[model samples]
Target: MATPNYGYEKRQKELAKKKKKEDKAREKAARKLNPSSPGLAQGDPETDVASLEHDAPTVPELPTKDG
Candidate 1:
């Protein structure tokens, strides 16, 4: 059986991490340029939660039907 090449695996992991960082930086720059874009807004958790709370449908805590 061939021996595992730890160095190759480590390099792959590092490359993947660097790529992820670069992609995130690019996305952040895009967001800054287009802060009002809907596509980017959905990616943000803060706005998601805030919008959810602000726009949540009414819930009846108690029954209001006629007796």
Candidate 2:
């Protein structure tokens, strides 16, 4: 008959928790350094979308856009 090693399991869980916290801290620091990074962008910026203008079309004015 073998006994369960609860202590080892508990230690492993603690280590995982510590690792997660450290990773979050590192990510926060990276974001602070470059907040505009698209891959890690979170929430919207302070700029107002209403202030933006569409003076130009991205794709050439389609010849048959009216249709």
User: Tens-digit lDDT track for model 2 on 3-25?
Assistant: 99999999999999999999999
Give lDDT per model, in order.
0.79, 0.69
Candidate 2 Cα errors over 4 Å, as ranges? 39-67
Q: Give the Cα-based TM-score of candidate 1 against the true structure.
A: 0.55
Clashes of 2: 0
Q: Write the residue-wise lDDT of candidate 1 on 1-67 in tens digits.
A: 9999999999999999999999999998887677677764664766554566677687778866874
> How many angstroms is residue 38 displaced in model 2 relative to the true structure, after the best TM-score fit?
2.0
TM-score of each: 0.55, 0.55
CA shift of 31, model 2, Å: 0.6
